[model samples]
Target chain A: MTTLLPRAGARPPGRGPRTAARRRERLTALGMVSPAVLLLLVFFVIPVVLAFALAFTSARLISPTPAHFVGLRNFTLLFQDPVFFRSLLNTAVFAAVVVPVQAGLALALALLVNTKVGGTNFFRTVYFVPVVTSMVVISIVWMFLYQKTGLVNHLIDTFSLGHLHGPDWLNDPSTALPAIIFMSVWQGVGFHMVIWLSGLQTIPADLHEAAAIDGADRWARFRHVTWPGLRATRTFVLITITIDALRLFTQVNVMTQGGPLDSTTTVVYQAVHTGYDQQQTAYASAISLVFFVLVLAVSLVQRFLTREKD
Target chain B: MATTPTPAPGPRRRTLRRIPGHLLRSALALLFVFPVVFMLISSFKPDQQIFADLGSIKAFLPVGQLSLDNYTAVFDRVPAGRFLLNSIVISAVTVVLGIVVNSLAAFALSRMRWPGRRLLLVLIIATLIVPFETFALPLVWWVNKLPWLELNGFHLALTEGWLDTYRVQILPFVANAFSVFLFHQYFQSIPKELDEAARMDGASWFGIYRRIVMPLSGPAVATVAILTFLPMWNSYLWPLMVVQDENLRPVMVGIQYFFQLNVSWGQIMAYSTMITVPVLALFLAFQRSFINSIASSGVKG
Candidate 1:
């Protein structure tokens, strides 16, 4: 809001002392900023360039050759790998299932709490407790709950249905990824619910009052008034969910280890395995680069979709 | 803006009748708390009893078998005390370093006029899009090349292996661009008039930031601490990558070993409950401020 200073409008007629002080301020600013800048450059920017370069090379984890350029060999291998294809499919399925389910649950919880109801704060706090709980702990606890003789099976068994034999939820390929998705949604819904609650509050009460005066029902008010005002928050939630769903790691790693038949092995998990276990650093980097591209492209699509809606 | 005085609703009032939304809310609240309650109760049950009878009221029944067996087993099996200590230290160090660096950087970025300021802001924010996984390989390569970290580097460090040292663990995490950006937005939102007035009083930029801006951004500081602590404590991949020594691993990483121990379900639940209790308690204590700051800060960007 302040205007740029003009040279001739100086309160004092001299520029030497002021210019010296300005130089000193500039030096101090640079001094304060350099540590953060240096760290970022060394850790983030430089490493990314190196990683990008390493993608085109043949670098094993413990090899001494320092990675010789191998052109598109790593990239080509990534495309043809059956496991990579499986991971792609699995990740797609996981995202598709988790995002909508979590979003719906979050919205429902938010709506429930946002009502003119007593003990709304209590419900909000209850749902949000899991959000702060460590994910690794949650995964470990859930892994027990999903064990062969775990509590989930016990519940299902009590139904006494002849066809309802419970499978090993973590080891079973059909159920492992879906089970992880379910846990992720349950743990994550609270954070977004809070976001949506805030968004709901931002919708002016007068709008609802006017809508009621027009004989609009609650559903109509939500559809026409609430949803439109919540566009920005929805966009934020959509992008965040997309990003988070792509970064899915702890649940799979802790519970399944992408196993039974590599059914739950996502790109990140596969990359960790390839790089750490297989010692194929170049191959892992290549896989990671592709995964990175996929995440970016999908997230960009999410951004555009929300932008169009807005 | 004209006001109309309306009579208060009487017992026979029809238009202002209250719905049973309160009851529905309580039901929803129960739904939310059900799993947590299940977890708490299950932690106290016998191992064999847990999977044997889960859904029925038999699961929730009080048992004379309830004891501290699971907790003792957890502590005995893993170095639970050490892991908790390491977690607290690392998270505290991260918060302290993160606050000092980020707040200073934010002060410079917000208050000082400099060339490439906008460019710096863009570069900082753009880093948020890059996943940490992408940076891990190259970062490890770089960290391994550090002279002080190496056996024969210029520091004349006698010890050979610092690979799993706390320095290696904490250094990389302390320079988060997200925290810097958070502080910047918070600092920028403070009116420029404050800084100008401070300057008029002959206060240096550092003095102004220390005496004025920093104190004004208390909520932001809390937000930063909580946000930073959550990820730092919850961090798994980075710790797994760097820390090979079982002794140095944090609680989250240590909890992963509970699976490998082939522990009983009740014991495992007890361990999960144990580690999560502190975090849960902290959340309960700070939920109001957490929600308040988040709602107001508008960091959705």
Candidate 2:
């Protein structure tokens, strides 16, 4: 194991069998990587570059007219539009609420299921069913459940014995975004729970036992040991949840269509709404560019915030 | 944390402590499963009966006149079978191609020393931070103008645009950044000495990748497959943009068809259940892999 690896530095001055082998290896590596590179360049790289370039052009999705440079026209229009502003605010609000709520809930869940008792796996599996289930499916089912005569209202009626009525959840503007936020959290929290549980497991049990021996109670041990151990998982959960919250489109597209006076409209939802539905490729690109900037800014801030103090 | 060499809690006290945990777990588990259970249960009942039973606990239980009537009605209402088949083919192809391509790239990056390897890896990983929604509109516009070479009988013809095709759905997703990262991370755990030994045995790099590295990478393969398949199967926004052909629509987009006018709750539940059950069954079957892979993806953070 102590033997030093023979790198290119180790190769004697050129034209040796080892040199030939190294060249062949490099060629094979290139061949192997090219397929992935080509695909990514075509799909991810080009499109991302296009996202930037097309933002300043008057490009239509499927038009006969060639795209012309439009300068700040799209941005000016975007600033003037109230719906886009609402969408951005809604995205921020969604992320602001979901990041903490989902991450905290997931940590709680991870701790609960991390016990070495029986049925932990069963509990984990049951909790993860919604994570595996499609958001589209969830949105549809919850749409039904949120109806005026749905199970949610019925349960409210039953619990109150006909004293109170649940609001029309997806229809009422006030409750629409909150309702979607709740479902989004429910659908995604299981994923972060697994992440947090893994982090918890990596925290050596002896630390907790040592803390316990030192008279640290449950909360004290958690604060000192468990919380510190979950730094990576916490960063992962918060960032993923925030990104996901900001990309809140499926439920909006499926359940509410960003409806009830655009209360539930998210940046991504409006991006799709304008990009695909209206075919204004350039304008949609502008929205998407802003969306990308928001994601980048938020992620950078999160990374900075979650960086290890030491 | 439970492993203690010293005097542990007495058996009665331990049981009492576990009691709260069990109760809490049971309660949380119930809360998580309730909506799915309601969807499944409601899929079988008539619309009226679904609402009728909603006032009671029976909303979640399979009570009263249960039938496959709504499931059958789902087929009558839309081309559910076509959507299912489309999603299956699209997701399956995407997963397979993704594993092959991404893992190969990972093999080259992780197992060999080459010029530009480090730069390529960083570039690929950098794409991971950008969400799909950010570039989806531009991708849509780009694909709309991109050309495809299609075979017509014996002739190869260049067809413009990939909209309304399976390739549009599958191709863009085949070179996933995270899958490549996963494979690279997994490959690093394999000792580099093995590659040298294989080279000493006169094995070519591709040979080593196929006969040695790939065969040893079952867990990575499964992890990549499951992760890739989930998004592909649940792919709504992409296909909703690209595919307008009813015959080419995936299941997630099928939900939109039910939303047009007079909405049928039972049929919606039925379709939702139909699309969701297969993924759930797959998840339960590969529960450990699903859980562990998602957990391990925290390596990025």
Top-scoring candidate (DockQ): 2
**How many backbone clashes does every candidate have?**
0, 0
**lDDT tens digits, residue span B1-301, model 1:** 1353665556325333544555666666665555566667778877776655565766656654677787888788888888888988998998898888888888888889878878998888898888887757656655655555345655545443336878777777777887888888888889999988999999998898899999999978998888788788888887876677887888788777765788876777777777778877888899887665544433445
Model 1, stretches more than 4 Å misplaced? Answer: A1-13, A157-165, A308-310, B1-31, B52-55, B149-155, B158-162, B292-298
Could you tell me which residue pairs clash in candidate 1? none
Candidate topping TM-score? 2
Task: Give the Å error, residue B143, model 2.
Answer: 0.4
Give model 2's docking category.
Answer: medium
Reference-based lDDT, residue A138, model 2: 84
Clash pairs of candidate 2?
Answer: none
DockQ of each: 0.52, 0.78
Chain B TM, cand. 2: 0.93
Tens-digit lDDT string for candidate 2 (A1-310): 3434444565554446667888998999999999999999999999999999999999999898899999999999999999999998998888889999999999889888887776779988999988888888888788888898887888789889899999999999999999998889998999888888888888998998999999999899999998888888788888888888888888998888899999999899899989899999999999999988988988999999999899
Q: After superposition, how far is residue A8 of candidate 2 from its true place, in Å?
A: 22
lDDT of each residue in A96-168, candidate 1, tens digit only: 9888889888988898788663566778888787788778877876776687776667667876654576889
